[model samples]
Target chain A: MAALDVAPAARRGRPGYDQNSMLEVIVEVFVDRGYDASSLDTIAKRLGLSKSAVYHHFTSKAEMLEIALERVLGELERVFDDAEALDLPAVERIRRIISEAVLVACARQQYLVLLLRLHGNSDVELNAMARRRELTARLSRIFEAARAEGGARDDIDPALAARLTFGLVNSLVEWYRPDGPDEPAALADTVLAFVRSGMLAADGRGPR
Target chain B: MAALDVAPAARRGRPGYDQNSMLEVIVEVFVDRGYDASSLDTIAKRLGLSKSAVYHHFTSKAEMLEIALERVLGELERVFDDAEALDLPAVERIRRIISEAVLVACARQQYLVLLLRLHGNSDVELNAMARRRELTARLSRIFEAARAEGGARDDIDPALAARLTFGLVNSLVEWYRPDGPDEPAALADTVLAFVRSGMLAADGRGPR
Candidate 1:
């Protein structure tokens, strides 16, 4: 999760923005201008740094993209690993994983957004996408396990259920503002509640 | 919905692709290449037609974008109008709207995908975003009404609930395939059921 912070000492030689801060600006630029359309010059201009200064942190735009993607993908992989190690039931693990993912997404919103927008146009993008597919498949297997344990509903397909559930989580990237009124904890609670029993009142009638 | 089909008779003077078909290829190109990056030449090359042949349907790329957006926006507006006309409770109307949106999205996947990707970079995009915001506000009001009438859980903010619900629907554009095993009817049912009662077994435990 602190992959960017791991090399604060490496910034001693570089003046102005450090590696973490530089990557943050670079990612913002990438998100605003499509990655394919964004060049090193565009990123350098946005950062108000010389091209060499930008190059001081990352060798190429593709490297920046790869590092940014790894930050999010690595965090997500950790979530899955931790969830799998738990002694709890598959249903509980699913809930915990989703709750943790909400926190990760909110904390690393820009990285996650960049990761989500990628369409595998390059080798770095393709690698990120492959990792993403593996994570998705892992979640689907958890859903399958939950259904098998009779904890989750059996009627819906597990793969479809996993997609819808995480899709709801991923949609937060579209509107979630870190400085907004809803704290990550409260937002996570709301998501969990909706995923648990939905928007209808507890006493409301069932689906027709 | 058939905005592109309105001028088919005008195609008699043109050769190769007709207005509707040309616009379809243009949209596909726009989706593949970001709208801002795509030009008339790029669109024509994708369609295997000359630039003037491409121009036979529309005067400019913006015009094509406007027409394409209107197709999805117009269909959505019709859904809202029809839902408002129903003599049901606010909660039921919300259900119908989400259900119908899934169908519209499934039928016009590319247009909806394009609409969802738009970031309001231009006048046409801004107009589409404005219309989209109005639709979201309308849905939020319905959620508010449902809450006031005790049909929906009041704990979650109505606006947040509206965004999350529709966000789930919108995410369908990311992964849904028309020729996939799940039919639109079945998809709609799954979505509605998930929105209504969520993914837990009927007799399952509540949220922690």
Candidate 2:
């Protein structure tokens, strides 16, 4: 749920560049320099175009941010929908979801990074956060169901457990580099194992 | 291992403000506005002062960042030292360390937020990361030792366990508010229970 502004009648479709390509370039610049510091002029220059060329496609910086975020949110929401539909056991559904999420993060890494790092500066960001909260609520319900079915531990508070799971997943933005030594599938396994079994010994035989 | 720039030469004596109070103000700004967006002028303005007044206390933004990071790191290192000296059983020590970490997070929340939100933008930030790496390594060793002593699971990877523990603790910055509903002790207990027992049912079930 991102806000998109319509360009002025004079500027709409008057771009020297393709609107879609220009949006892609803007997304790249936003990820590179952060949303606040990245300027339209810098983005235009990087694309070998003029500032007017950039303005023809998007009305302002906020418009670009919303478009980029919309792309990410659409993809993420799709994955969650797929996970929700899987006709498997809860653990299996979760595993499949985790694997798919890793692939999504790797494939759409920049957009996902931007989505995860939103600092809530503007009304658009506030709107995005509300969408995020709604999604979080849905995920939390899934976790609750899984726990109710005895897939997750009843010992841990479901709300806290849900938050911890999401946190572990989100922290991937901080360290999971696509070019790093680990392959995406392998990285997913490592992450999955950590989330499932934790760091302690399986036999509960680790040192104090 | 944060670099401490000496207070500016002109600020050696004057008295109305000094390095510590200035740091307090800086931390507040950092927590309020994401670090990259906060300027020296903003910090000064928040203090009802001028740019010179801010500069008098610190040479640049990096200096403020270093001091803010050091406040948290210094406390972290001390906690590790204290945990190491305790003669308690390994499981108890682990619980104590986790509890202490949550308390540290609650008390020095801003500095801890700064520590947790590093984006790897500079050498200083990278160095801070290196420090975190070393701390994680040390904690991993402790967990490994505890595992060896048969207090934890033998099948779990020590490194992943440590990261999960870290993930749980670090996630506190993202959501936990000191003035929030949960009590610190209660939150710590929830975390400890989850880490020990895990998200699975007592029957060791997988998601469904």
lDDT of 1: 0.83
Q: Which digits, one per residue and each the tens of the lDDT, describe model 2 over residues A55-145? A: 7778888888888878777877787899898786676666666677767777677787677667787888877877766666666777778
Best candidate per lDDT, number? Answer: 1
Q: Distance from true position, residue A189, model 2, in Å? A: 3.7
Give the DockQ-based CAPRI class for model 1.
Answer: acceptable
lDDT of each: 0.83, 0.72
- For model 2, the superposed segments whose C-alpha errors exceed 4 Å read A1-33, A37-59, A86-96, A202-208, B1-22, B50-52, B84-96, B143-158, B204-208
Model 1 residue B202 CA deviation in Å: 3.7
- Per DockQ, the best of the predicted structures is 1
lDDT of 1 by residue, B1-208 (tens): 6677565544454356667877887888877656766777888777766798777778888889999999999999999999999898988999899999999989998899788777666789889989998999999999999999887888889999999999889988778898888898899999987887788665534422
Q: Which stretches of candidate 1 lie over 4 Å from their true place?
A: A1-14, A37-41, A203-208, B1-15, B36-42, B203-208
Q: What is the TM-score of chain A in candidate 1?
A: 0.89
For all candidates, state DockQ relative to the true structure. Answer: 0.40, 0.27
Write one digit per residue (lDDT tens) for candidate 2, span B1-208.
1222223433444357767767776787887777887887888888778888778778888988987898789888777888889897666677778888877776777888888767667777888878987777777777888887877666556665676587778877777876888777788877776666555454434221
